[model samples]
Target: MLKRQKRSITTTLLTTLFICSLSITAHARRSGGPTPSITATPVVIEHIERNLSSLGSLKANQSINIAPQIGGRIVSLMIDDGHFVTQGETLLTLDSREQAAKVNEAKITVKDAERQLSYMVKLFEKRAVSQDELAAQEAQVERAKANLSSHMANLDYYTVTAPFDGVLGFNDLSTGAMITAGSNITTLDDLSTMKLYFELPENTFSEITTGTIIQATTDAYPDHPFTGTIDAINPRIDPVNLTFSARASLDNTNNQLRPGMLMRLNVVRPTIATLVVPARSVLFDGNDQYVYILDEEGLPQQRYIETGIILENKITITHGLAEGDYIVDKGVVKVTAGRPVKILSTEIAENHLDTVEPAGDARS
Candidate 1:
């Protein structure tokens, strides 16, 4: 009877201990002790832009090397280096005392010829000369007038004038310096606007057109971006490189950009409304790309996705995602499919949200 009582007490004690262990296990499971914590953001529907990038060079809207049309000794320098000049403004003058004397002589000859022609006409009317003789005298008067006009035109060449409104450049010529015809005296550039020349592959010819927007950056002004429009496109592709040339014009009201500077161009293509997610949310597994999304039951569901262009830490989802879907934007590698997750907070994912205001609120 004593041995039976001892055995029954041992059995009861073992049963109580087993029941306590089962209760503890159930409590831990209900409280989610094994669930992983993560940050999540909703997929956004926004406009995604694609850009075509290329290198280019900046140039002045109009540039020219000023030279003289006639050779002579420089007598006066009307413009200084880097002077802003207007159209038809006198730039320099050459010594032309000899040319001036030739013009005066031609004028005197013209007067003499006119007097002789008049005297001859009167003599012919009185029968002092024949009709043919009067005609010959009239021809002499015309020849003298032509000679005078030629001399007058040659005298005008002694002065050089600006062809357009622009800023002047430096020149070696000075007062009393002898220069030859066609010699470069200086340069002029119109800085109110600038031009950019770049090339793209011939395959993109159809996509580029006049009035397309362009944004450009240069090392000289890295922080500032210049905007312009496509002004022209080459009609034929270059046979050597199979590329087409494009030109864009931008305002240079401040005259900051200079010719020959290297620039990087971004040609903005049309945008499309699409679904996007944070770049961090996408994961790569060999040839496949995927993300972890929260299902209706709050469990992780692996989703394979197709991606397009990426910009500003955001990526476009071409397939396998929808607007308003939630994805694991942070701590993606820590969780797997069907795993229970606890979202820590929404603050961390605020930046990845679509911030576009509704149309009704926009009007207000």
Candidate 2:
């Protein structure tokens, strides 16, 4: 009899607990769930950009391989490696004994022709020479002068001179070494300035232009960053790469930069108008991203958003959200759809050039 009474008490207790749970669930359903405390922020039109980073190649303002035009035995080398030379400075010389003899012989022939022409003029005046003969003598003198000029020009080929003011590279050829014509004797580079060559995608056509600022750094000197402006842009786009090449000139008066050094560059494009929201306010679920947007009824609603580049702590909203729309910025995790939120605070966007958002009241 005592065991039966104990069973009856246990059943009563279970029934009472079930009834209380039902009542609580009914009350919650009527109330539409609990309200969450959150901070709301209106989307703002902000200036944002994704800085472009690219690899570039460094080159001197002017660079060339120093070579001789004529082949002969090298008799002299006036400058060594790493030496600065001015334009038209004699750099190297080849054996010119035979060339010098030819020039002297040509000069003698010119003088003889001139002397004969002067005697022919006198003979023609005395009627001892025909008019045709006198004309022939004058033509011989002209031909002799042309021959002399040619020999003199050939004589200058034996000597090599600096083409411009620049720094010299290594000279492997020593004096008295036999070298062929067009053999590379050394290298010369005008390092007063540097040219940075890089490519940009065709999409940056409107944003990137002459006078765009760019910063570059080389692995050789990472700490030192070089700054320059885009001075030249290739008008033609590369058909294969779909990119256009640009040239930036940086002042290297100290001669710190060298040609052929691989450099990294950053294109500092100007920021443009874009819709932005706080990065922390956005939540990602698989491939879709969403944020809690407060509705006219003060209830939180789940709104999916498409995002673009993120700068600082703000993310760009490309679609699904417009400027001046309110979103749950703080306490987003606690926000539930169709549930009212306690307005802890708010941040509203001001449509002005100043761009600073004024704070809202903190009181709920």
What C-alpha RMSD separates each model from the true structure?
A: 14.6, 9.6
Q: Which ten residues in a row have the lowest lDDT in candidate 2?
A: 348-357
What's the residue-level lDDT of 180 in candidate 1? 96
lDDT of each: 0.86, 0.85
lDDT of 1 by residue, 1-364 (tens): 9999999999999999999999998787666565555777889899867789999998888999988889999999987899889989999999999999999999999999999999998999899999999999899999999999999998999999998899999987779999999999999998889999999989889999999999999999999999999999999999999999999998999888998999999998998898989998899989999999877665679999999878789899999999878888666776768766556435423432332111211110
- Score every model by TM-score: 0.67, 0.78
Query: Candidate 2 lDDT, tens digit per residue, 1-364?
Result: 9999999999999999999999998798677775555677889998766678889998999999988888999898887789899999999999999999999999999999999999999999999999999999999999999999999998999989988999999977788899998999889999999999999998887778899999999988899999999999999998899899999998997778999999899999877899999998999899999998866666678999999887778999999898878888877887677765666552322222132223443322
Q: Output the worst ten-in-a-row residue range by lDDT, candidate 1.
A: 355-364
Q: List the residue pairs that clash in candidate 1.
A: none
Measured with C-alpha atoms, the lDDT of residue 351 in candidate 2 is 24
What lDDT would candidate 1 get against the real structure?
A: 0.86
C-alpha root-mean-square deviation, candidate 2: 9.6
